[model samples]
Target: MARNTERRSALADAGIRVLAEQGARGLTHRAVDVAAGTPRGTASNYFPSRDDLISALVGRIGERLTPDPTRLSSHAARTPDRDLFADYLRDVVRRLSTDPHVPLALFELRLEAARRPAVAKALGAWRQRAFEDDVAFNDESDLPGGRTEIALFHYAIDGLMLDNLTAPIDSGLSVDAAIDELVDRILR
Candidate 1:
């Protein structure tokens, strides 16, 4: 099958939607083709196997979740302090929450990873790469947090997103306030 970047990306996006709506079990080449409104076997042509399709989904998720460089530059232009860090956190929350399906799809992938070692390997690599990239960005921007602190924040973010996206422990919780407090208390 000839490679089509645009169609491949569309299929990947459709795969994400299927995963988000129907979960990992529902993720299939046919499902992706259906979601993308492409002909049957289109997704299979793009991703020959389930693993290949999953790998494509993982890469696409990273691309979709990447923080905007222009926005990051704006944040970096400000003082590299706790408040600034909180602002970055706010941006993260905004990004994840704005597109609820993306995070939901990510959660589905993470769940599938626990059962399938192949999925785990692919997902783990993507996560590790993202973590390293975030750490590098922090180091470059002279952020207050180091590796350990960033790791802590990463853990906190996962929990926060899971809770907020699924069923929040507190329905009336203010995410911004939580982020502010997290920055104030977590970052030194």
Candidate 2:
């Protein structure tokens, strides 16, 4: 059983590497087996279908993006620090830049989820949970735009991620400057 699990993990990691380097269409059990250094038939032993393999791969990637609810709750206990937001933006950008494969995996999973209802539902649940927490944290009571404004603010961030993933993002903008621009736009 342990050996089987190890083989499964190896296959999943291999799949990520393949998808990252060649995109989703290039993924195959033979490719993953070669990448993982496992026997050609090893992938089939664990992942009987391509969808099954992809589901595992997507779940693993999604887990990375799913924020810990408890962590946000703990942060909420402290007073808002403007500097922290800048730090977070910097961290996010750094991660995006350094881990180019992460966004690629995310894009593949997101696109696949669009075609599969079950996958889409799961992704939607994960996204909703994350968005709910953000909405709770940034609640602006009686503000004209209120939650809609917050949602749009988040939408812009998502758009930024997609744009950066699609093209080389300029390195000139400091994280603080970017956050300040976002805050300025949203606050007004």
Candidate 3:
């Protein structure tokens, strides 16, 4: 069972790389097999159809993007202040900037989701998980506005991340500064 889990994880990672490099049109069982460096037919054995593979890939991306509970707990325990929240936002921006492929693949999946119902369903669930996590984090930190604040925060961060990833220009303000400004506006 563990071996199967590992293999599935490897295939999912390969699928992400393929999606990043080749886009949705290029994501296929055979392509994933080649990217994974495994024998041919491995991806097919795990994910029987394109929708299945896409679904798995969506889950995999969520896993990569979401902060672990332990990390969240440690951060909250250390200092549940606005500064810590700003630091968390900075880390999020840093990950998006440094690991461009992950977001690139995610964007591809999002575009694909428009045309594929299964992919759309997976994305919806993934988004819900993120929303829930944000709510929990806000509650734990004793932040105001509850879900409304989280909704705005997510929208702002999404825009910032998309802009930063697409056309990163030195606008005199660092990413950290931008995050601080946004967080302040949202939390205030």
Candidate 4:
């Protein structure tokens, strides 16, 4: 049977919520069905297997975390400089933190990947493509950084998001200040 795109998206989103709240072990098909408010086996009917469900989650997270194209293009039109880079990074973080469940579920999947190769395989490929897309965007926009610099920013941004979502080491520390510092030190 042909799967409904909307239903699949909803199920995957529900899976994200389940993963965020209950971790990988709790992300069963029934759990996703419950989260989506669908009948029993709805998620399984759509996904067919756990791996398929995970692949859908990875795809949906990419959609959720993607930068808004309007904002992205406006930033791209800016004169490339450290300030612009910092602003771009700020937007990236804002998108990441907009939905608490998206990042929380992402971290949960990353941790689960250590034991489940299926998760690793799906997430790894998705992350690599995302990295390449970032590099391409930076290059096309004349952003003040090379691929290595972009990689460093990615690492820093992930750490910053993790801190914000989980528990901050210093609650009073300024994320903006940290982003500025990263741009100042990494870009120029």
Per-residue CA lDDT of model 4 for 48-166, tens digit only, reads 89999999999999999888889977876778888898998999998888889999999999998999998999999999999999999888888788999999999999999998887
TM-score of 2: 0.69
Give the count of colliding residue pairs in each prediction.
0, 0, 0, 0
lDDT of each: 0.90, 0.66, 0.82, 0.91
Regions more than 4 Å wrong, model 3 = 1-3
Ranked by TM-score, the better of candidates 1 and 2 is 1
RMSD of candidates 1 onward, in order: 1.2, 4.4, 2.2, 1.2
Q: Native-vs-model 4 lDDT?
A: 0.91
Model 2 lDDT per residue over 1-188, tens place:
12566566667878887888877688888888888898887877777787677776766565545445675465556555544444434544555555667667767767867788875776677667767765765553222234676577567666677777787478676545766677666666
TM-score, per-candidate, Cα-based: 0.96, 0.69, 0.89, 0.96
Better of 1 and 3 by lDDT: 1
Which residues of candidate 4, in runs, are more than 4 Å off? none
1 or 3, greater by TM-score = 1
lDDT per residue as tens, model 1, 53-167: 9999999998888899899878877998788888988888888887788899999999999999999999999999988988988898888988888888888898999998887
- In model 2, the clashing pairs are none
